[model samples]
Target: MSLATSPATAATETRETQRWAYPALLALMALAIGISASPAPLYGLYADEWHFAPITTTVVFSAYAVAALVSVLVVGSISDRFGRRRVLLTAVATLIAGLVVFMTAGGVAALLVARVLHGFAVGAIVVAGSAALLDLRPAEGAATGKRTGVAFNIGITIAVVGTAVDAQYGPSPLVAPYAALAVLTALGLVAVILMRETHRDGRAVALHIARPRVPASIAADFSFSALGVMASWSVLGVFLSLVPGIASRAAGTDNLVFGGGVVAVMAAFAGVSQLLAVRVPAKRAAITGDFGTAAALLITVAAVDAGGRWEIVAAAAILGFFFGLAFGSSLRHLGQVVPAAHRGEVMSAFYVLAYLAMAVPTVLAGWAATTWSADSVFTPFMVAVALACLLAGGLGLRVPRLTPDAVPAH
Candidate 1:
């Protein structure tokens, strides 16, 4: 016998590793996303410690998100050249370094650096993890690898709540959570080590990062639906970036847990709504989400003015529910309109526009906060959100009702 190992034995070993690979990727993905969100609560802490203006806070918040956004654009296809396992291992190690920076950050500059590092790591982690999951899809199919972003939502929720608690009550509030997460991310590194490389011949594959663009045939439809998509998606972005400060101001308390809880409420309800959204008709969901989000945003503006914390929570639920309704349907609507040959380019454009659209009101709010009163930023920000949602609602009314098959898997 050659006796290197029995063929049957080797097969069993591969099967065993592959079996573990799925959950490993799932855990690592969740952890990576969770790390991206952990800083939401801590941003408030950073402001208090550094006495930075609201503009600085907004800049701090945007640093990571924008970095991740650009990184996704730049490296979204990098794994096609380098292989999934190699990219994944680099991402996790980078995540660890980012956490270490967060632990030791002493000023605004360090925080920004840490956030950008974390953002790049997350971008790489998401893209690479997504590809890795496809590589190891088991013979028995359950949900597809991404699972409709349930994992992403859950990760955001858990991280917000847990890091909030750590910041609120831990002896080493700033250090402890990041320290804990660093350990968890290190486990993710180990998971990547266990995973077999999917793209062994990746070196021969072409790598080209295309700029975002849609064919003219699809541009008008994309523009209209994108109104709904961008408006609805902006709610989540606004909450993640500015809501903690808004919540603290609305509640007249700086309780880290309370502010973070508002975000948790949005994430949890949004997650549940994802499961429920499919049951509703696509047109109805889009209509309700578009108009409902506008109304809720207007109400949220009032709640902030009236200093109503619980009202903010209610608005979170309403906004989240409606967001769940509109955003997914809008993507499906956009997807159906695009030609298969150009779907990738169109979707990339869709994402880029959505990200930039979200930044508009947020960046303005941050700048306005510095120039005017802290609460003054809320007026323009909420008004902007409401107006965008209203625009979407009007356009969405004209969209043709999609057949059941028109809705893409999220």
Candidate 2:
């Protein structure tokens, strides 16, 4: 068939090639999220087996966040010049190795190594995958935008849910979750092998490795968004580190299912809030959500002090609702401010702030837990986070609204 006469055939071939790529990318993202959370449910098991204290557990978790922050800072934009597929493949391989380490974990050393490796894998995958999604934007009439948003949200939600389900029901708390993640990482590796590469070749190599240059236009905007990310992730870190223990003690719920459920509830709510942000103005959502979250945190602290499981659960649910809103709005704003070319680098920087918030606060809180009652430790944390929310919300209101044309260059 003549090439010009066979346009339909050529188009069909092109689409068939691209068909598996997007879905595979989404799957890889989901797998990364699952691996990140899998350790949470197993911490209790590791604590018993390794005879580690709460501070040690927090250190293990914090190590991952620290590694992730470092990776994002060092190589966040490398995928922009080197193909996204290559970067993502390496990420999957690293994750599989991390899982292996976790499976063989006999001491704190193995756990720390596993956590750091997983952190690197997550950092690389998030930067590469998000860039790939932007590259794969569809024709104007297609449902690409909505699909991208949904895929991102779903990937995160699945991770949260899978961590809870696997940890709760799996055969061995320590070994099973990591093993399952290894399987998932293998699947992701295969998917990447079969997919078409999306990023362009031969762009300036200097551009790939350079530190993110935040444009003046977007710096202020990104600052606000980054603050929100920091606050939200800090809360996430605290919940991951302490909530399980709190639930076991206050709620008398020692089951992995219950622990994971509380964590998953917050994540699921965040997913829902992201979808809702499609309809609401970003600033409005931020203000409302932040205030609500602040209030919820205060109530949660009070309830924990009261020493009742039901009250804590109620408070957690309330906290989850507002956190969902805050996370969604912040992410939406992030999508808006950074242009496509510099997205990976900007996002890397953004997450640097986020993981820092996630890691440092937990470490401090862990120290506080050792020196004081859990309730005493949480009271100050709650007050500080509430104040952060109020400041972010107030600043968001004061800033002029961003329009399509006014969007900042990263």
Q: Evaluated with TM-score, which candidate comes out highest?
A: 1
Q: Could you tell me how far off, in angstroms, the CA of residue 75 lies in candidate 1 after the best superposition? A: 2.0
Best by lDDT: 1
Per-residue lDDT tens digits for candidate 1, residues 1-410, read 25676644544455456788767777788888888878888777888888888778777767777777786776757887777788888888999999999999999998889889988889888877776665565443325422636677788889989988988999887899999898888887887887776654324666777578878766666776688877866666667767887789778988889888888877777667766765666556676778888888888787777888788888777777777667765665666567778866887788777766656555667788889956776767777878888888887667554334344433
User: Against the hidden reference, what TM-scores do the models get?
Assistant: 0.89, 0.86
Q: Per-residue alpha-carbon lDDT of model 2 for 293-390, expressed as tens digits?
A: 88888998888777676676677777877887786676666667677687666766777688899999988888887687454677898789988987
Compared with the true structure, all predictions reach lDDT values of 0.75, 0.72
Identify the runs in model 2 with alpha carbons over 4 angstroms from their true place.
1-16, 138-169, 201-204, 207-213, 306-311, 334-348, 373-375, 402-410
